[model samples]
Target: MHLLVTGFEPFGNDQFNASGEAVRLVPDKADGHRITKAILPVSFQRSGEVLAALLQDHQPDALICVGEAGGRDEISLEVQGANVDDARIPDNDGAQPVKQSIVRGGEDYRPATLDPEIILKALHQAGHGAYLSEDAGRFVCNRIAYLAYGQKVPALFIHVPALRPEGQKATVGAETDNREAALKAQPRTSCTLPELAEALTVVLASLADQMK
Candidate 1:
């Protein structure tokens, strides 16, 4: 089986997105199935087009799209995508769509064809923080997830926090206290890019087993 995995580029104030970094680390093969990687733009207009083209080119048996979710400590296996685009900020291409439907005539929501429970369990067993999330948010992540599902693809989205560098607390979505002398005293809840890569490997293994 050929599997398609994708991640978004750096958007917002982030210098690097863990999703894209992790996707880049995924091996070329997982559980004897070929894996194809796509580094997608954070633009609403171009993301769909890029994903559609990859789908056409690869005809992957399953699709997994990954993105950064600030403030989330765990890897989120998003279960559903709403037909809405309510961006809190403009995308990479300066597109800030408000209350827009992802697909003009698509369903109000699209449930991921992949089994979220199984994926969540795999991540847990692999010692990665993970959970089943109902909302992929009304952002680019949701748009791609809903699009893939609507097109009858076994697809889902995974959200990861910004990777924690060597000696700094991941401040992606944290409040810093001026009173604290040591930044390390602030809780560090985010994982590294390598951890995210391992998490995806676990997910792919589970998917391969399920597809069989």
Candidate 2:
């Protein structure tokens, strides 16, 4: 099976996104499945465009979109993607849509094709902190998932917790001092990049087994 796994770039006050870093660490292959990984922008409009292009180029059997969810201690296997774009803060391109429909005349909710319960069980057996989450939020992460659902492919969104401070390199810019400080000040549950990568590999393997 071929899998197209995606992660997001840094947004808001975050210096680094755990999802982007973790996807970089994920192996090229898992359980006889070919994996193509890409990092997406944190923009509502651009993220969807990029994801659409990737889907066209790769045309994978399954799609897995990963994003960083701060304050969440466990890896989240999202079950549904609401067709809403209510951003608490502006995205990377400074576009914040409030109560906007992702696709006009689309369904209010799109259920994920991947079974979160089965993936949750696999993660537990592998000793990873994971849970089934119904909400994917109304940010860019949810927007990508909502767009992906229209592609007629099996799609799932996984939310990874923040990365440990040591897991990401400090940004080298005097201008980003305040943003860096703010990121450090936020109280968040974090995990190592390796840990997230391992959990994602397990997820891919499990998904491949399910397809068989």
Candidate 3:
């Protein structure tokens, strides 16, 4: 089975993007399967073109896209994408969408059609911390998820958070009261580039089986 995976470059203020790291790491751990990777810029025009080209080139049996979700603390298996576009911050290209639907004339892509029960069971059985999540967020995460759904392929997105660095506190202060000190308190989540790559390999391998 051919698998095509994608990750995005660091967007916004983040210094590191775990999703991109995961995409880079998985192929090394995977043995004896055809896999390809595409790293994307968080731009509206570029994403669709890149995605289309990737699908065309790889002709993959399955598509998996990974992106950073900064604050999320879990391995999220995205379920659906709202016919919405609301960005709190501009993407890496410094252009935010005011009223966009990922696809111009597309309908709400619901996740109810996917066989999550099978995928979820496989993921946990493979020993990775995984869960079925509803929101892929309104950012680039949902954009690609919906595109895959539109293409009549079994596609899904996984979201990882910005890994807290070593020796940091478990929690950071909100603001205005020594945020620098609070930033110092945040504990790292152990979700490193290499670690996420290993986890993604396990997840994708299980998914490829389910595809069969």
Deviation of model 3 at 104, angstroms: 3.3
Sort the candidates on TM-score, descending order.
Answer: 2, 1, 3
> What are the lDDT scores of the predictions, listed in order?
0.79, 0.80, 0.66
TM-score of each: 0.88, 0.89, 0.82
Candidate 2, lDDT over the whole model: 0.80
Clash count for candidate 3 is 5
Better of 2 and 3 by lDDT: 2
Pick out the ten consecutive residues of candidate 1 with the lowest summed lDDT.
173-182
With candidate 2 superimposed using the best TM-score fit, by how many Å does residue 172's alpha carbon deviate from the native? Answer: 18
Please report, as a residue range, the 10-residue window in candidate 2 with the lowest summed lDDT. 170-179
By TM-score, the better pick of 2 and 3 is 2
Shift of residue 55 alpha carbon in model 2, Å: 0.6
Q: Model 3: per-residue lDDT, tens digit, 73-163? A: 5566777765656565577777777656766677876563346566677667766667777766566666777676667667777776556
Error of 2 at 12 (Å): 1.8
